[model samples]
Target: MRLRRSPAAVAAAVAALVVALAGTLTGCGTGERAAADGGNERFTLRIGVIGSGNRLTGPVGYLHDRNALVPLLAEAGVADITVHTFPNGPDLNQALVAGELDLATYGDTPALVARGAGQPTRLIAQAQVGMDAGIVAKKQGGPRSLQELAGRRIATQTGSYMHRYLLGALSDAKVTPKEIVHIYSSDVEAALERGDVDAAAVPAANVEALRAKGYPVIDSLAEDHPAYRGTSATVVTDAFLEARPGFVKVWQAAQVEATRRAKANWDDYLSFAVKVGGFPPEIVRRTTLAEQLPDTPFTEEGLTLLEGTKRFLVEQGFVRRDFAIDDWIAPGARG
Candidate 1:
């Protein structure tokens, strides 16, 4: 006593069942998305770095160029990655303030400045430690030593690590300059050549090149004053951290992996540095050798350096307000 349905009726029934199953699957997908993203899905992760040519340098850049972070970030529900480069750290901080970047890796000086200025950013990692800064003067007629630069016009990119080094070294030597003009790092060479600046504070890698070109290196932070060496900071916006809770952990893992690969293939890393930094091979090798990339997000030595830098910035009035370094660091990053 069963009756068979018409062909059209059976077709309609099958279509309805298909729709029901699709709805169930989609509902599950939405639930998973909410759980992963804390109620909203963020598919893009924007990162800022301090460099030109829209290229990221160092171990992070090395891994990024190879797509090594793709799979690692996918675990955190990020499907797209974009990197923006700035000419200096202040520009990078501006992008962060404008809500244009989720994270940034740059000199510690600007990072502290932004934090002191009430920017809600967290220090997620210290990318490199013991970075050196140097001062190069005109060979023809320029100060031969840090003491000689007293009452002379000097140039450095304001709010940069080199700027911090210059101030600290000069203060320690009790020398006051006539002026410290704000010049972009890229234009420092030209300013020196034109005699626009008696000397310029630059990265250590540039010291050798300037010396070869007859520019005399008057002082180096690493050689003359190790206490003033800079460190690179990897920081995340508070909003992004809240949206993507798993990002910091994954990022640190990726950094460790990148460091491993870079060390194993040391020569390849040197080549990468030369290409990205536009420095000679020997300079790259020497500078790279001096930098210590932490296997963990935060090492004792790295944290110590960061604390010292923050204290110096505050004491020197570069940072108007002082904040606890511990509170600024993200959770689970101290290991």
Candidate 2:
């Protein structure tokens, strides 16, 4: 999940940019270019990805390392591309705002935050769908219903898409956030294990990990219900698209290929994910790969789900206002 960066993070990104730029101009630092030098075209598409610390990010980084992305990107005239990983939402958003990333995949919240903050960003594509979210507990097993959590402590990251999921879950049960003790993300899972928190919101992989140790899940966001479906996607800066139209088309095509492979050869992809991404085979098997629309179109139905999410956040005061859906989506998206 992504959110607006704190001013401090923004400042740090700016400082880093300044230092990097100075190094490049003075030829003092290790400033490398991602281009095939026939001494002509320099095509580098720098992108922000989730930090290396996360298990999910490993396979994607490997895809790049093994040069799988090179030939694909080359088709789009992006002969050289760099994928930058940040540890958290704030830093990732900060890098995007600072023009560090041409495109990236993130949760709905951060895309809205970037648009709301007047960054020239747009939701251009989808990376995945379907939530892997669930609720876990250590004592008395998992709650059978949301009502069981009355006055119980729950942990989740504030300003996260999971936070929206948690709020939606509470609303589904006619409960309010005020009714539960809210804890931060860093400590949520641990708190649940130690009995400091009664329940914690967890993504699918973590759920599998925790379940191995006997933590029972009370509820899950991965319900078959239509309302709980749909998750994260890709977003890009308008400036980047303007600068490299050829690259954008190729990048989208590459994602389409990946999605096709994911759907058609689920078992193989999962195995590849385990081998390359370092995700355990069990976790890969348990984690749902997002469904692609028939035409693979980023449609109004998709936008509607995101719009509803934004409205939920606004209603809950997570964001200041409800943004026009068109403002966040790209032009010609329906086409």
Best by TM-score: 1
Model 1 regions lying over 4 Å from their true place:
1-42
Q: What TM-score, to 2 decimals, does candidate 1 have? A: 0.87
- lDDT per residue, candidate 1, 1-335, as tens digits? 01121211322333343345444323433233444656346577778998787777778788777787667667776777788998777667766755667789999888887787666688998889888879999766889998899888898877778888888898899998888888887788899988998999998777777877888888988989888788889998666676566778888888888888888888988888898989888878877862477777788887787788788878876666688999999976775
RMSD of each: 17.3, 5.8
TM-score of each: 0.87, 0.76
Going through the candidates in order, what is the number of backbone clashes in each? 0, 0
The regions of model 2 sitting more than 4 angstroms off are 1-40, 53-66, 140-144, 177-188, 275-279, 290-301
**Tens-digit per-residue lDDT, 240-332, candidate 2:** 554444555566666666566556656756666676545478886767454432225365566667777777756654454457877666766
Query: Model 1's lDDT to the true fold?
Result: 0.76
Worst 10 residues of 1 by lDDT: 1-10
